[model samples]
Target: MPAVTVDNILTLPRIETPALTAVDRPVRTVTTAPTGYEGEGFPVHRAFAGIDMGALDPFIHMDQMGEINYAPGEPKGTPWHPHRGFETVTYMIDGIMEHQDSNGGGGTIGGGDTQWMTAGGGILHIETPPEHLVMSGGLFHGVQLWVNLPRSDKMAAPRYQDITGNKVALLSSQDGGALVRVIAGEVAAHQGPGSTYTPIALSHTTIAPGASLTLPWNPEYNALVYVLAGQGTVGVERRPIRSGQTVVFGKGDTLTVAAADTQDSRSQSLEVFVMGGKPLREPVAMAGPFVMNTRAEVIEAFEDFQAGRLGSIPAAHESL
Candidate 1:
C-alpha cells in the first residue's frame, strides 16, 4: 500500500453534542468467555463473537494487542490493509503505534491516547509500531475494536478522530477507589471526546482493592466487559472474572464492577473496559477486510479499491 501523502489532509471534525439521559438500571451478571490466543503480533486475544454474533451486533470484533516485548528486527505490526463499512478504534495503554490512511491522514498514538478511524466508504492503511520501537525494542500494549456501520451510513466519507489520553474524560468514584476514562458516549455528566456515528459507550476503568462502582448504561445497548488486569466480580450475581476474560451482560441499565478486597498479597488492581452499543441488527456481508450489507456490495468494495476510487496514501509524506 502507498504511504499517505500530505495532500488532501482531512481536518478534524467537530463532535456532535450528545443528549445525556438519566436511568436507573438493574445490574446482573451475564456470561463469561476466555481468550483464544496469545502470540507475537498485534492481537493477543480475539473475541469476535464469544456469545452470538447477533448478541453483539454493531460491534463485530474485539482484540487486545501487546503487553509484550518486541525485540529489534522482530515482526511487530500489521502492514498495509483495507477496510470498508466500519470503524476501528485503537487505544494505547503502554506504547505508541503510528498509522497512515489513504485520506492523507496519519499520526502516532501513545500511552493514554486513542485513534478512532471511520473506514466508511473505503480506505487502505497501515498501522505499525513506531520505527524507533521496532528498532530499539520496547513494550507495547493496547486494545483495538471493530465497530460496524449501519447500512444507511456505509458510504459516508471516511474520517479520523485522534484524541489524546488527556482529552478523554476521566471520572473518579466518590471514594477515589475507582476511575473511569470515557472514550465515547456519556458517563454521568462527563462525555467522551469521540464522535461516534452510533450511540455507544466505551470506557476503561480501574478500581483499587475494595472499591466498587455502579454505572448507569443505556438499556437498549448490549453491554460487554473485558478484564484487562487483576480479578473482579460483575453485576448483581457477582460473576467472578479475571484477566483475559470477557463478560457479556444481558439487558439492564446499570453495571457494577468491584475490585476484590482480599488478604492475599498477590491481589492486584482490577482494570476493565466496559463497552455497549445499540444493535444495528442489520444484514451483514463480510469479506476479509471489507464488510457490507450484501455480498454484491462486498464485491464492489474490492473493485473500487483496485481502481483507486477510495483514495491513496502518498508514498513520500512523513506525517499528516
Candidate 2:
C-alpha cells in the first residue's frame, strides 16, 4: 500500500476541487481540451477523449491512447520539448522507444515498459528509434498522460522513473487472467514502484478475453480507463468501449469494465490507468506546450526557455 500521508507533497493542493478531490465519488462527465487524434498536429476524431482525474491531485489529461505505425526505414518519434509544473507517464505496450532527456536520463523502453518523468521546474526530452529496429510495419502503442503538479511543488526539482517488465509486480485473478497492480497504490496483492510523489496510485491492469474486472477507486481520487486491444464493455454508467477507445469517469464511486467477444478469442486485454488526488480548484489556463493557473505563469515558462534561462540539454543528439 502507498504510505500516502499529507506531508508527501504538501505544496500541491488540498482536497477542494470537486473534480479530483476524492475517489469513487460520483463524477459527472465534463468536456476538456487537447482531445482527438493527431496524424500530424491535425484533429481526425471529432472529440479525442481524455481522462480527467476527478477530485484527485496532479492528474490533468489522460491522452487515453495512441497507436503509431512505422514503415521500413521511416522515422517517427517525439523531439525535444519542455514541460513545467507537471509530469508525463509514457507506457509502451507494443514495439520499442528510445528515450533521452535533458536531465541526463537515457534508456530504451520496450513493450510493457514505463517511463515516468516529473517536470517540476522544467525539462526537455526526445524519443527516437534504434537502427534496424523496425523494418516492416511496426506497431507503436501506448498512452502519454499529463499530470498537473500541485501548486506548492510547482517549483520543486524534476525527477524520472523507468520501470521495465518482469521488474513490475503482477497479481492475477484465479483464472490467470485479469492482472492488478499497485503501480502507485495497493491493489489486491501486487505493489508498484515507490516514488517521491506519494498519495498517488497508478494502476496497470489487464483482463483476459471474456473476463470481467472492476478496478477499485478511492472516491478520494480521480480515475480513467483506456482500452488497449480487443473490445471492452465499461459499466461506469453501462457504457461500452471498443479497441482504441478511452472511457473517463469523474466523481464516480467505481469504474467497471468487461471484455466483449474477441476474434480468434484474441487473448485480448485492456490497459487501464487509475489516478486521483485532491482537486486543485484553481483556474487552469492552458495553451499549446504549457499549462498554468494564469497567463503570466505561462509567459514566464515560454520566455525562460527562449532566453536560455533553462539550459541543460546536450547541444547535439546522437540519433539511433
Candidate 3:
C-alpha cells in the first residue's frame, strides 16, 4: 500500500523502469550559474547557477550547487518569507539547516539529510544555517529545487519531509552507487522521503571513472539535469556537461551517462538532482521575493503580507 493518510497526498504507483535510449552525442558546454547569487556569512561562494525558478513550470529550478559557511551568532540567513503555488526540496551535502515553517512541520537536517517543504496555497517560513560552520567550519553545500504545484494542490495544506541518510536506502555496486534513492517514484529498492506528495525520483551518486549508468525518464513530465561534482558526458545525445550546469532534456525513456573524467572521481560523486511534473501552464507574475500565477495574485500576496495575513514564520532567534 502507498503511504497515504488523512493528508490526501497520493503518490503515483511505482512501475518497471525501461531501458535507456541512447542519444547522438553527450552533454555539451552550458551556463551553470545563470541567476545572480548572493553569499551570506563566510560561505566560500554563494551564487545562482540557473534560471530563477520564478519562471519555469513543472520543473521550476535546480540550484546547481551551494556552498554554505558558518560564523557563530552572525545570524546569516534568510528571514521569514511566503511561498505560494510551489514546493521547495532542499538536499544537503555538508552541514545542517534549522528549518521552521507555519504548517507545523520543521526540523534540522544534518549532512545527507533531505527536507521537502510544500508551500501549497501559502506558507510562511525561514531557514538558518547551523552554528557549527561558524567556528569549526560549519559548511553548507546542497541543492534547492523548486517544483511547481498543480492548480488542484496550489492552495493545499503545507507539508514537510525530514529525510535522513539512515532512513534512505542506497542501491550500489562494486563500481559505485547505482542509485541514491531520493523520492523513489514507485521504483523498487529505492525509497526517499516525501514520496507521498510528488511522484519524484531524486538521487546523488558517484559513477567511477569510465563507469556508466542508464536511468529511467518520465515522458509525462518535463525532464532536466544538474551536474554538481566533476565533469561528465551524458551519452546518446548530450554535450560535455561539466560541474555546475543544468540540462533541459528533449524527449526519451531513459538517460545514459558516462564519466567525463577518466581519472577517477577525485572531486566527488556525480551529484545531480532530477525532477518533473505536470505543468501549471499559467501566467506567472513574480515580485521581489514571491511567486504567483498572475499579476493580480502577486499584488494580492504582497497586500496580504502588509496586512499581517501571511502567517507566523520561524526566526533564527525567535521561539518556534
Candidate 4:
C-alpha cells in the first residue's frame, strides 16, 4: 500500500472541495473481483470482470497483481507476448519488476514506479522479477491496466514511458485525511507524468479511517473506483464496499468515497484505485493478446506475430 507517502500529509497540496451545486455521481454498480492467477502463476484479481465493455470504453482490462508475500524462488511473471491496439500500464506499489520489449524499450521498475508501454500496431514484451527478488522473495503488489487506443491510433508507432514514484503528482483531500497519487492525467489542475493516447485520469488514494473525499471529475468521462484494500462506502447514497470490489459511477461532476470508522488490522486504511476516461464508443474485437476493431484484424495480428512481424526477444534476454 506504500505506493507513495509523505511524513506529514497536511503539507501536500489540497484538492479543492467541489462546489455545493456540483453533481455527486451515483453508484451504478458494485462488482467484486474474482481471484485468479496470471503470468507465470502469480496471483491476481481480475479487476474488470463482469463489467460491461461499453462502461469500460477506453479501458480494456485490468488486473490487481497480488498483495501476497512470496517465498524465496517463488516469484513469477509473464512470458514473452505480443500486444497490439492498446497500451499496458504497469504500476508497482511494492517489489520490483523488469521489463523488456522488442521496440528497444525496457527498464526496471520498483515500488511506486510505473512502466507504460504503448503496443500500438504491434510489439513483443516480457515482464519478470529481477533475479535478486526471485532469490530473496518478498511482497509484490501492483496493477496492470490496458487502455484502448482509438481506431485512428491503433496502428500508431509504439512508445514507452517510465514514471517513477517521485514524478507522480501528490495531493491531499480537503481535510488532509486522504493522500491521492496521480499516475496519469490531470487532477484538480495538477497533472501526472505519464502521457496517454486516451484522455484519462488514474490515481491511487488512501483514505484514513472515517475520512471522506470528494473528487472533482470530468463530466464527460466515466468514473470507476476500485477498492484495493480495507472497507469503504461510495457515492452520496453511501453504498458499502470492501476490498476486491469495484464501484462504477454514473454521470456526474464529482465522486465521493468514505472509509469505514474501523478497519481490519491487516489494512490500516482504505486504499482505492480511481480511474475515468472519455468513452471511445468504437466497436471492439479482442483476442487473447490483441485488441482490434474486427475479428479479422485480431486474426491478422496473431498471424503477424507468429510470422515474426511483431518482434523478437532481445539477444540478451533470450535465456529468460
Best by TM-score: 4
Runs of candidate 3 with Cα error greater than 4 angstroms are: 1-29, 35-56, 68-75, 173-177, 184-191, 196-199, 263-266, 314-320
Q: What TM-score do all the candidates reach, one by one? A: 0.85, 0.77, 0.78, 0.99
- Candidates 2 and 4, the one with greater TM-score: 4
Quick one: ranking by TM-score, best first?
4, 1, 3, 2
Better of 1 and 2 by TM-score: 1
lDDT of 4 by residue, 1-320 (tens): 77879999999999997898999999999999999999889999999999999899889999999988999999999999999999999999889999989999999999889999999999999999999999999999999999999999999999999999999999999889999999999877789999999999999999999999999999989999989899989999999999999899999999999999999998999999999999999999998889999999999999999999998999987996
lDDT of each: 0.75, 0.59, 0.58, 0.94
> Residue 28 CA error for candidate 3 (Å)?
9.2
Candidate 3 per-residue C-alpha lDDT over 64-123 given as tens digits, one digit per residue, 9 for 90 to 100? 335544445543555677777678887777766778887778888766778888887677
On residues 1-320, what C-alpha lDDT tens digit does candidate 2 reach at each position? 11111232223222121234324433244333344653234122222344343433456665633355567865456667777877778766666777777787768877667788887777777766665565564666666666776677776687888877655655555454466544555443345673635356676666666776655556655555555556666664546665555555665555666766562243335545555455566666666666777899989989988876554568667442
Best by lDDT: 4
TM-score of 1: 0.85
User: Ten-residue segment with the worst summed lDDT in candidate 3?
Assistant: 1-10
Cα lDDT over the full model 1: 0.75
Q: What does candidate 1's lDDT look like per residue over 126-197, in tens digits?
A: 887777787888777788988999888898899999988778776766666667788998875568999999
Backbone clashes (count) for model 1: 5
